[model samples]
Target: MDKRSLTQLTERFRESEKRTEILRQELAAAIRQAAADDVPQKDICEATGYTRQQIRRIVLAGETETAAQP
Candidate 1:
């Protein structure tokens, strides 16, 4: 592709990735709530397709980001 076309494609892909991260964060928040409600870690990992450690990090990161917001 030409430079102009490549630039446009790159911008579109970046925007799509941003949108996807929004969904991912939302999912993390929901998973955090589920865990708080006594859901097992292994069950959460199985349902969310994230490993146990990844789930912990996601929940912690989500909490940190939310706490940082006004």
Candidate 2:
């Protein structure tokens, strides 16, 4: 591939990564809310395809990020 094409592709990949990060944060927030609403952790895991440990970490991270907000 040409240098210009590679550069454009790299930019597009970075943009996609940024978008994915935003969506991931949104998902983490929703997961935290689900946990708080008395939803079963196993159910959440099944629905989200995340292990219990991962879910816990995501929730913790989400809480920390939220608490850091002004």
Candidate 3:
């Protein structure tokens, strides 16, 4: 590809990556909130298509964050 085309493609890829990261953080936050609110983990997994272990990790991370707060 030409230099201009390559630069445009690179910009698009960067934007896409940023969006992917934002969505991932948002999803993780949502999952953590639901778990904190006593929503069933299995239901969250089924709805979000994530494994139980992954959900557990996310919940644990949130717990750790709260414990560290002043």
Candidate 4:
């Protein structure tokens, strides 16, 4: 492949990674909000298609980051 094409592909891949990170943060925030609103863990798991452990970790991680943000 031409260097120009390869560079463009690399840039697109990097953009995709950035978007993925933003979505992950949004998902974590949504999960934390749902938990605060008294949503059940099972309901969260079902809605998010994540295991209970995964949902718990996301919520805990979000809380930790929020607490550290001043």
TM-score of 2: 0.85
User: What's the true lDDT of residue 38 in model 2?
Assistant: 86
Report every candidate's CA lDDT: 0.89, 0.94, 0.94, 0.94
| Model 1 residue 25 lDDT score | 70
- Predicted candidate 3 versus true structure: per-residue lDDT over 1-70, tens digit per residue: 9999999999999999999999998999999989878999889999999999999998898888989999
User: How far does residue 47 in candidate 1 sit from its true spot (Å)?
Assistant: 1.0
**Between which residue pairs do clashes occur in model 2?**
none
Ranking by TM-score: 3, 4, 2, 1
> Over 4 Å off in model 1, which ranges?
62-70
Off by over 4 Å in 4: none
Q: Give the TM-score of candidate 4.
A: 0.89
| CA lDDT for candidate 3 | 0.94
Q: How well is each residue in 8-68 modelled by candidate 4, as lDDT tens digits?
A: 9999999999999999889989999999999999999999999999998988988888899
Error of 1 at 6 (Å): 0.9
Alpha carbon lDDT of residue 22, candidate 3? 99
Candidate 3 residue pairs in clash (backbone atoms < 3 Å): none
